[model samples]
Target chain A: MEGDAAGIMDKSINVLIVDDYRTMLRIIRNLLKQLEFENVEEATDGREALAKLRAGNFGLVISDWNMQPMTGLDLLKEVRADPRLKATPFIMVTAESKTENVIAAKQAGVSNYIVKPFNAETLREKIEKVLAHA
Target chain B: MPDGLRGRGASAAAAPPPPPSAEAIEAAVRAVLGSLEGDLTAKEAALLAELEALGRTVRRVKAEIAALGVEDITASHIPSATDELDAVVEHTAAATNEILDCCETLERLEPQLGGEGQAALRGAITRIYEACSFQDITGQRIAKVVAALKAIEARVAAVVGTVARVAPAADAGGAAASPAEAAAGARPPPTEGQALAQGPQLPGAGVSQDEIDRLLASFD
Candidate 1:
């Protein structure tokens, strides 16, 4: 079981985190680092995130829902529309837990959702579940 | 006598002149009615022009109020500012907890380290604890911003209410989309992204993580 857990959680996968808040970016980055995911990148909004996603071969995406110009939901839609990027695992980390939002995100092909004020353990669990399915 | 004087005297002597002809009396009455109608039409046109000018003035006032960007300030700036401040509080509190967690982790590892390493870890933990003081200061400062934003929001709402009352028709389709009516029919429908991006939720307002997990599981 421990070996399986280690196999599922490949620590070297590159992670792209999207948020408009610098502090949140730092916090998530630190938490990812604590989880031994050292290869983490950050984008301030969904537009920059899309650009980066198109430019790089990211293994996972953890994004916030609210941002100017482009939102995470729009980014998700764009990713899903693109055949090449549609298969990448995506986790939405946001404070939007409204049933409609959850249903919308689920329909948009989100792999998992984590509410805000979450700890490292919650993040790890979500990440593990996402990657395991990936 | 001269012929002209003789004719005038003869007409003056004409026995009582017959009452004015019917045609002549009717012409006289028609002239008076025409004058009265013309006066009434002119007055009506003037009154209508005044009313149209008033409507334009009210519209201009509404436009100026919109131009003041009160709607932008209340709808966009204040909400985003408060959200940012709330994020500050959330991040600081999270960071403080993480720092404490690190300190505890270090303490647990102290027994495994040499004397110098243990001392260094202990000192580092102390410094981290000291750094956690920022959370309190930041929270207090955020509270101030929140209070200021509340005051501004209230003032903007009052201005909006006054405008709405003064010229309800003018503001019927204007920038009166306050936060309260954001979900109502008075506001334009939100775009898909705007609808989905509800920002952060208040405590107990959002669903729990476990509930979300269950919800997602049900989707399968």
Candidate 2:
């Protein structure tokens, strides 16, 4: 899967992981590192994620669903609405996988969904799917 | 009798000789009762009016509570936060389990490995140790969640007070008690809808990954 998507899974590609939980952010960062993808950044919530998204040229945006003041869904909408960021591949990583939540994310143009307690392989598959689709 | 009354007594007696009529006495008695009845009726009407106002206030409070969706907030929103905490617990467990697996792997390999291999395994073990630090961060996140639950509990207590304030004067003593008393007496039992309110569900208990994939495929 490493060379499958024209090196879309390239280790140096920058990825932004947004989560309110520091543990979750570190866990994800470690998993990405395990996958040989090290150029990772972090944000605490959707508000910070939006600011970071504006400032950085990230290849992938991975965010958690539940957050204060703004949710990942809201961030997705903001990103999609912006012409500059509209084409950016976005993935939702959350513990909540309710049907309504999934449907909403899909409608808002989420690239993929990864439930919590996932493994490195699952993360790899989700990233590959998102990048390939984009 | 006085001397002046004694002098007039025969004349007074002559006039009084036409004895007081029974009909006149009956009429006086009737007049007294009528006045008393009027007063009683007015008092009853005032009491009834007060009761009606109380009823209206109670109904308004009920409507306000329904509008606030207190049940849903307690049943759904608070529990959702709880579910996130549950997920955190599960994630913590998984992280610990992975670390254990790494330890076992290293233990088995330590006996067979040479010097450089031992160093490589040590580095791997160190990384696992660092990853396990998630528990500390999870602890911080749990504290935040506990704070949030406390806020929700306070809000629920406030709502209880709102409902209790509508109690009639007769029940004022009992109703004006603390929110806990009000909740203990009036809170509805957790409904079927509230079953999910306990915590983040297990894989089989919640929407399965296969189901999620199917739903995702639908969007495509």
Candidate with top lDDT is 1
Q: CA lDDT, every prediction?
A: 0.73, 0.68
Name the 10 consecutive residues with the lowest summed lDDT in model 1 chain B: B164-173
TM-score quality measure for candidate 2? 0.54
The collision pairs in model 2 are none
Model 2 agreement with the true structure over A30-127: per-residue lDDT tens digits:
66765668799999988899999999888899998767556788888899999999999999877565776778788888888876555556677888
Query: How does residue B32 of candidate 1 score in lDDT?
Result: 48
In terms of lDDT, model 2 sits at 0.68
Which lDDT tens digits does candidate 1 get at residues B1-220? 9999998889979853534322334445455444554445776667655655655565676668767767677679999999998998998788777876776677678879978998787667654544554454456446667967977876676565445333243244333444444535565665687677655555687788899989999999
Off by over 4 Å in 2: A1-3, A6-8, B1-156, B159-205
Local accuracy of candidate 1 as per-residue lDDT tens digits, A46-84:
899999999998999999887767888988888888888
True contacts kept of each: 0.40, 0.17
Give the runs in model 1 whose Cα sits over 4 Å from its true position.
A1-3, B1-190
